[model samples]
Target: MVTAKPSLELVAEVLNGHPRSISRLISRVEARDPECRPALAQIYEHTGRAHLIGITGVPGSGKSTLVRELALAARKTDRTIGIIAIDPSSPFSGGAILGDRIRMNELTGDPGIFIRSMATRGALGGLARASMDAVDLLDAAGFDMILLETVGVGQDEVDIVQAAHTTVVVSAPGLGDDVQAMKAGLLEISDIHVVSKCDRADANKTIIDLKAMLSLGLRMNSTTGWQPPVVRTSAEAKEGIDELLAAIDRHREHLQHSGELAQRRRRTAEMRMLKTAEDILRARFISRDDDIVVDLVERVITRALDPYTAALNLLATLDEGKSDDGGKKRP
Candidate 1:
């Protein structure tokens, strides 16, 4: 275990691209350790250089293989890559269950590629809360490309759009019902659609279906004159890797030239601000004594008050900045 260092020292180490320091700092960020705040605040200044590409899809869509292949292809252009793979949390340990490190063993010795596996830890929308923080740290470390692979939670993984500049939604043939993708809102959020396992016979059908969907203008970003393209790839055959990379590059250029990049950055900032506020409020609510909450629950259970009224009373108490005793003011 790496011992914690002073925030300034840690920040310097991270800025120098020391892998161990980067990993340790990411751990601190993931745990939401208050001690790392100063370092993170400094680190944020060096971010926004890396292109954040979000890859998400349902389970068994071969997302891992595609990511590994994509990284290799990008590295050929001398681009340093940072991959953040979000895995389902282990029930007992609350750690990443499907380790991407093990899966991408072939890319182990490369200094240019950094892979970090994160556990969802019961956070919804397929990403851990600190995933973006980790992205910032890698960006500060000078990675040219950052691939954020979210947990394959069929629907509701749409949260990737808020975090990634280019969102790629992967689909594989034979993944049971296709309607789940639609229900997941992937159709609306994708900037690029990837049909993986294209070597399979049914792969073309998936590509065609995605094209059909795209034709309907389900992707709202089309208003900017950018149409999402469907790229087919077979990781085993190594076909379409360059095409996918080209598409990513083209999308990046499009964003910059069309001025959508600034809009995305603004949207991301707004989301981070709102999310941080919500997190602080939730932490305050959780840390308080449960007496008031318990009393409200009992009243609601006994029919003395409705849930809404009890909630209003609770909020009113919170608004007054009173302590658990309901009279003493908070510092």
Candidate 2:
């Protein structure tokens, strides 16, 4: 006799804060397993309650350190937390190269905090395709706050803006030209700008440059009259972290009062739905005969058909096939 798959009840138990089941559920979601859908459906209702916070910036800006400090500060309020650290993937194993858990050793053994490190797997914006799903799972698992730390890639880090309710862009002194942060499009998406490593000698200069940039209206202003505040923090020294946390709380409050929280959640849902539909379409396209795709590619290579026209033809073929299947199922 074959063993049956775990029921949604078991998954629900996990969502009710079962520690052992959390990682297993996340793995299933990451693998895109069909069996995970029922659990996700039930868990979906419990999401949107957690405060989703995104932390991103250039490499060596001390993002991981700040994330740790932020988590610690949040714990002081007796809030449970979840952390998703997106690390660069190893070329050979496609596993997270940097051990984020090791860096967050201080938070270990805390039942209230769940930490997960995901490999980017070459995805743009330094996020895995399953990052959002992981977030939802954590939210359903009853974490009061969720922090998403992106791989420290420059411009592409903007993708986190759509995934989190609050986006924090971190910068530090001695990381080269401070002006580069303004040009990299970080200001536009940031809900809070953190000048990290304030203990450094040039930290004051970095903070001044950030304030100057904000004063110039380079950062996008929220319709709620909320201006993204630039906060200073020395994660290593644990100085100014409370101020940074307060800034995040103020931004959250602003979003709630201005009705922007609902708007942001709606946008996040729209993006996730679109990404799912795109993945389904791509899979359907590739599931057709291999020879057909090979032939199409060969024709394009030999100038027999342009790529745009070929794509249209392929889409048409897929549509016709779907119509044929529907007809067969009728009566």
Candidate 3:
């Protein structure tokens, strides 16, 4: 006798704001369990309701602190929040080293907020595929706001732009030349520029430089026509948190009014679908132990077939298999 699989209905309590169920569902998604797909399919329909926000900046730019403050403030407004903090992977354990939960200890006790820390796990752009899936689960769970905090590796941290409805680029006063650094794709993707640690003396300079850059039409590929606002915040002091939230609200409104929000969600869905298909195809290819792949590898090693040629042949073999299946069905 076979064991019965868990029903998604069993986890309906998770969808109804049960923290334990939410955690278990996210874990199942992150593990990429095959059974989770059906449950995720049901959950996906309820998504696109939460406001997804991406926060990224330099390593010491105080992103985690700002996120904590933001969560605290958002809670006061009666909003439920789900936060995904992406941390650098540990070299040995391959887990998140910084542990954002510890950093956000204050908010842990709050029933309205859920915080999850994920490791980069060799994924570039500071996010793993699992992280995106987890975000979907959180959104489906009915959170009013979802905040994604990246690993903060400068210009390469642009993946959040695709995943977030509103991308906030955080910067501090003394992180080298702000103007020159902004030229490296951050300016293009930023929907809101935040100058964290505003209590520093050089904070004004950073603000001015960002404003000058914006005035020069530096944003080339923004999704919205609304100019990105620059807001200063000292997360430790909690100053300007309200202003930052206000800017985010305005950007959210702009996205809705300018009809960019729907476009962003559509783009995100398209990308996710393509990525899922790619992963499935890749897994099928790797699992095949056929003589064709062995022969192709040997040919490449012997310099008879170039890698590019061998790759095309492999794909051709897959297509041929599909065609043969179709022919058999017709007969």
| Predicted model with the maximum lDDT | 1
Q: lDDT of each model, Cα atoms only?
A: 0.85, 0.82, 0.81
Stretches off by above 4 angstroms in model 1 are: 90-96, 218-221, 322-331
Worst 10 residues of 3 by lDDT: 1-10
Candidate 3 segments whose C-alpha is farther than 4 A from its true place: 1-7, 90-95, 218-223, 291-302, 320-331
lDDT per residue for candidate 1 within 33-77, as digits (tens), equals 778888899999999999999998888787888889999999999
What TM-score does candidate 2 get on C-alpha atoms?
A: 0.92
Q: For residues 173-204, what per-residue lDDT tens digits would candidate 2 score against the true structure?
A: 99888456455577777888999988889999
Question: All candidates: CA RMSD in angstroms?
Answer: 2.9, 3.2, 4.0
Query: What ranking of all candidate models by lDDT puts the best one first?
Result: 1, 2, 3
Please provide, for model 3 over 1-331, each residue's C-alpha lDDT reduced to its tens digit, 9 standing for 90 to 100.
1123363753576578777776777777766677777887877777778999999888888889989999988888999999999888776877667566766899987888988888777677767767878887788778999999998767666888888999998989988885587676787788999999999999999999888888788455443478888899997676999988899999999889999988998888887788777767766676665678889999999999999999999888887766766523110
Distance from true location, Cα of 50 in model 3, Å: 0.7
